[model samples]
Target chain A: MVLRRFLPALPPLLAFAGILAIWELLSLYFGLDGLPPPSVALRQVPVILTDPQSLFDIVDSLRRMAIGIVLALVFAIPVGLWMGRSRFAAAFFNPLLSVIYPVPKAALMPIIMLWLGVGDASKILVIFLGVTLPLIYHSYQGSRAVEEKLLWSAAAMGMQPPARLARIVLPAALPEILVGCRTALVLGLITMVTSEMIARQTGIGNLVFQSLEMGIYDTVYAMIVIIGALGFILDVLFERLRGWLVGWAEPAQSIIVGST
Target chain B: MIRFRQKQRSFTFERGFRLERGLALAFAIAASTAGLTAASAQTIPTIRVGWTVPAEDAKYWMMKRPQEFPNLGKKYNVEWVQFQGTAQMVQAMAAGALDCSTQGVLSLAQGAASAGLQTYIVAQHVGEKAPESFSVYWAVKDDSPIKSVKDFKGKTIGLNVLGTGIWGPLAIALKKNGIDPDKDVKLVEAAFPTQEDAIRTGRLDVGVLNQPFAARAEAKGGLRKVFAISEEIPDIVHILEACSKTFVDKNPELAALYVQDLTAGMGKALANRDETLKIVTEIFKAPVAVFDPFYFKTRASSDAPLGSADFARDPGAAANYDGIQKMFKLYYDVGMLPKQLDVKDFKHAKIFAPLKP
Candidate 1:
């Protein structure tokens, strides 16, 4: 059984291994005159890690990610729930959202700097704004997807509004809500880097932009690898956390001994 | 009776067809004649000049606002757009998106030379003591033990980039003070706007800042300058207004017009410094008063006719070029450049070439 399960994943693993090999070969073949090879970029990893500033960068990025995710959730879920439940609220907000949702967040950097100065507050707020729209849209959709029958049954039973929301609607909407949270989590991470790119003094985005400007291609790739790894870790951790909290919904299976 | 009706129908069809053909022929001839007249009509030529300095900041040259490349518009058609950095403006010049631009002398020199763009210094914004006017300063936290350029050894010094403007000036200044800027100090790269914040947050031990940013840092009280490029490298040329050789070659008259307009702008800039400050205020959208320290309203007249003497005449040029040669040599030494990029490789036939009136 172990062999069967493990063997089935080998193809994907082999494919990834092939890609890494190709990357290494290409960098070495091309030489470091233009773009540094993977090995050279990797060599800088130890140096990048040993420095306290690099660690501080990681911590700062995570801190921003946390703030952004928290803000997204706080605003998205409540507004999403209300709009999902109330037709009037949806009508009022939909038109405004349709107009604003497509505006790029990078364009807001100059204005944000003018208002907030070049500080952490502006970076965080821009990330929050970028992540919130997608989260709210997704969660709002999820909440609306809740079965009308379930809501109708709860209402017919004379259940209090709070009890109905907590028991019937929220649980039914949990899976979709989690999906929206996942999207927001990823968007928060991306915008955190993007905001730093535009009007920031520190953080991985600023570091990468600085390195590229100075033509230090090695540092750029190294920073990119680190950021990608951080994103992956965040995604995995969120997945595990969501699993633990909402694991009760995991379908249980039963087997009948028809042979016996 | 049927035959008579058929004949009448044929006559009606023939008359109608002839009438339609005549109308179509008349319309086609009239449209072609009208188009021929329109094709020969002359349209006024419009020139767009890109400068990193905001129009308000550049108000002395202003006809009105930052975007309006005045005098040129009044005399000839010209629009000036301002950017926050020389890098962007140079990029525009490289892409043929700009007709002319004003960039830091160092940046414009390197860019023009490399891109094979014929560039000439049209005007100068002169300042007192090159080193004092344009030096990179080392600043440490008020309570920190870092006291001098020598103390910066083994510590990271924040600069915009390596092997560029600040790198060269800082290297010479540091070496003069008895330290190898390259080997002793770690140059940390940061954007111009972020230098103050980096210094304030204690992320950077010292930073090399220019006028507006430097002034902003001084106001915050956390940063105190330990040394400046101006004090060490006095009378340094920071920026020059330039245009491409191709542009000048293609439109010499227009190029001359540009130089005249720039000279006019510089004159206007110095004549009405207070009014210019108001212009800078509107362009940057920052407080109008931010203009007071970054720009020396009166000191700009130090260089006569705006485009005065050759850089060869300036002592700061000795240090500046020596520093650039050293930087180029470092790049060659470290295999950063494929071959030694002599100063000649980066210059054109018209480098500091006079803009004829």
Candidate 2:
């Protein structure tokens, strides 16, 4: 029974190990200076973590990302839900969102910095813009799929419109909203790195580029490993939260496909 | 029932219209207040300058050692913006987001010829000094059999980009050596930081390096230099400090003060190498070891006395119009520029006039 309790974690661990093995084999076979092997890269991970400045930059980046994600969630969910419920709201916002969706959020960094100086505000704003679209999209999907009969029943029971949206639609749509949040989390990290690279300010992205500029290949790869690990950990924790929040809902069909 | 549904739809439309109008009014009020605040705060004109490489650009030092530049925050305030590359800086300038920036001659020509951006060459940032100064280096693995430029034929070459400062000189060198740059060699775009590793790993037969990267590669000591860019284009103006003509014309006094402060700051920084390196280290957040060997090395020629400390920037000296003209012509010849530009037309003579003795 104890073994069974821990069994669910085994596949991911095995898969991660398999990936490392493949990476090591490839790096050794290529023997390229630009492409350091996993062992060499992993050794530098501790060095990076130990460096106070690098650690601070990374933590600062995470702080900006968290704030951006929270801001996006606060703003995007209501707009998305309103659009899902009212045709007018959807019509009014769809065109604007469509225009913005195609533009890479990182590309807006230079223009945004011109308006709002090259500080935390600009970086956080870029991350927020990047994460908002997916959240809005998923929330719209979830809220739109909420049972019409349930909403009608709540209305007959004298529930106000706002109360019905909060208590009924939100919980019903939590699963899809979480999925959107998962995608937004990934996008937020991407935008954070990309904007920092463009701005060349203090952040993990700046550290990565600075290391690249200095020809510190091991440090570059080490940063990659750290970011990848962060993404993996965040995704796993989010999956647990999703399971807890929507345990009553049917389990999503697991498809064997490429990783997100 | 149909009449009642129609009435409900009409009421919803009215509510939506009213909400939209209210939001529009709020946005207008907020925007006007922000504009007013910005206008009130602009006591002194702020020159938004963009820089890429901190170790190379003097603006980085000027901003770091504010005391050395007395004109800063008094005559004009400087707002420094760090960019990833010249391409991004060019975009920022075109967008009117940047007032002044460090630009390569290729980009300067491209900006004027292709984008029609009226940018004036304000001062020289970096240039080659013959026989001693090397602007760029082409290197191969120490064990590679390739000995000279002729051997570069049919071999892969790594460059930071295809048609920037390095490409024109390299093309001239290759063509002079009877190797067609286009048909004979395969040019791959790799970042400067990765070029050393790329060469060492045998991925590239030759990797081009400049300044700090060249210093790092030399310290590592496995790469052999095939040729230097200065050998082909002697005394080539590698980079120039350029500003939009509009900015220079509108605020000539501010522009002049900025140039004076920059020149003075560079002089002071070069005068005290150890202190300057400390500031640079703090700015880059990297070790002083990265820039110690070659950051401010100026070769002693007959014209330029020993310990004169050019540091590849001579803001007080005359603009190298001949060298710049040659570069513009080369860029046009190589199709990097859409049209030929007269170098003299783009020189901000008014701003540099005060520097004349």
Candidate 3:
């Protein structure tokens, strides 16, 4: 059973090794100063992790990302649920959301910075804007698929409208909602990096650009590796949590490897 | 019940569509009339200026010492917008967000040629009239085989930005040394701060270093200066103060007043070295020691006054059209500029007229 359990991990580990091999080969073939080999880049990962300043930047970025995702969850889930249940609410908000959906949240940093200044507020707001959309989208989809019978039964059992929504629709829609949360989690990280890159204040994004500017190729690649690892680890951890929370639900018909 | 629900849904969607269309139309009309409204408002017009680095742009210093420019608040207000690069500033200008900003010749050319951003060069910002003033240094590791510019023929040289202020001079230097800049050597974009480390590690043959970075590299040891930008392009105008043509045409008096205030501010900054240094350090959030040695000081070779003359002088005079034309030609020759640009066409005669001695 232990051997079988560990077998599932082998393919991904092999894929990781294959990717590194390809990267190393490409760097060697190009022989460009800017494109350092995987080994060289990997060596700098520990240096970045050990360095207090870089560590602080990474942690600060995660902290902002966490706050933004939480704010998005608190605000988006309800609105999404409302929109899904009420045709009027959906009609009212659908056009507005559609207009906002295509706008690159990171591109709003300059205007947002003008209004909110360059501190944590602007960065967090950008992350919030980024993470909010997917959560709302996913929650809407999830709640829309919730059984009308379940909501009716809750109401028949003396549950009020709000209670019916909270108890019956929320649980029934949770699997899809969790999927949205996972997507938002990825978007939060992207928005955090992009906003920081534009602002150039401080963060992992700033550190990455700073390294590039200084011609520290290894450090730049190392940052990419670290951020990639963070995304992967977060997705895995969230996947485990999702399994724990919605284990009784039927398996999704199609597993989406990448989230929108 | 289903028929009623369908009717209600259609009604809501129709209302939503109408609302969206109405709001969009209102926004378009408001946007179209915004310029006219501002023109008639008769309030103090705010000149939105974009800046990237605090140390490089004089506008940052001028804004810091507002008391020096008497016309700052009374005649006009300066809204300083921070940008990460000149390309972004160009985009902002194109979007009508910025009225004036410091731009390198390469950016100015690219903006005019490709981006269709018409702007008037009001005054010179920074120049390399050297042996006296600070010049960008291209350095290499002390033990590296690249002894001179000629030795860079086959080696990769790192630049802060690919085709901006420094690239023009480096291209000129390489051409002068009979090295075809395009084919003979490799140029990669690297930040000034990292160039020293890159060179030391043999990752780069030559790394471009600008002020503070050069000084810091020197203090750190292990790197030797291969060439100074001034050697190739003496008296080169590195950066120019450009005001949007639309802004200039609309408010000629304001544009001229802004230039006058700018020149006066530079004069004051030059006169008060101690205070200027303090302000610079405060803006950069660095130690005064990093800047004191070369902030505005002429090289030890010349006996010029300890003032702005070394960095920027005689704002009243027309721009150094000769030097600017040289830069344009160099950029054109380098294939950096899409086409050759004449300096006379871009100069704002009226704005600089008051400042002319």
Query: What is the DockQ for all candidates, taken in turn?
Result: 0.01, 0.14, 0.07
lDDT tens string, model 2, B83-196? 788877786787677888878888878877777888877776677766556457799998998999999999999999777777988888888889998899999999887788
Worst 10 contiguous positions by lDDT, candidate 3 chain B: B1-10
Ranking by lDDT: 2, 3, 1
Point to the candidate with the largest lDDT. Answer: 2
After superposition, which runs of candidate 1 have C-alpha atoms over 4 Å from their true positions? Answer: A1-260, B1-42, B54-60, B63-71, B126-134, B175-183, B297-357
Winner by DockQ between candidate 3 and candidate 1: 3
Q: What is the lDDT of residue A49 in candidate 1?
A: 74
Task: Give a tens-digit lDDT track for model 2, residues A1-260.
Answer: 99999999999889999999999998988876678888888998998899888888897787778778877877998888888999999999999999999999998888887676666778889999999999999989999998888889889999999987766776677668888999998998899898787665568987788677666678788999999988989888878766655544644344544444
Model 3, A1-260: lDDT tens digits are: 99999999999999999999999999998665578999988988998799776788797788778767777877898999988899998999899999999999999987776566555777889999999988989889988997777777767889898876666666667778889999998999899889886544457886676555435578789999999999999999888867656655644354444454
Residue A134, candidate 2: how far off, in angstroms? Answer: 2.2
Ranking by TM-score: 2, 3, 1
Off by over 4 Å in 3: A1-129, A137-149, A154-193, A199-260, B1-43, B54-57, B302-318, B353-357
Model 1 agreement with the true structure over A116-170: per-residue lDDT tens digits = 6445667777888888887778767877987887778778989887776556655
Q: Which candidate is the best by TM-score?
A: 2
TM-score of model 3 (CA atoms): 0.64
For candidate 1, write residues B1-357 as lDDT tens digits.
Answer: 112111111112123333345336535654553343242333556565655433223323453543546445555565554444675566656666566766665566556546655555444443335422334466777887888777877887888765555455567667777887657877888765566667766778887665555555566566677766555545555555666667767876776666655555555555665876776543332455454655542224443211111122221111234444455565454334445556554343433322334
The CA lDDT at B316 in model 1 is: 15
Q: Score candidate 3 by lDDT.
A: 0.74
Task: Kindly report which residue stretches of model 2 are placed more than 4 angstroms away from their true locations once superposed.
Answer: A1-32, A36-56, A63-67, A86-125, A159-163, A229-260, B1-45, B73-75, B142-147, B177-179, B219-222, B298-311, B315-319, B353-357
- Could you give the candidate ranking by DockQ, starting with the highest? 2, 3, 1
Better of 1 and 3 by lDDT: 3
* Each prediction's number of clashing residue pairs: 23, 0, 5
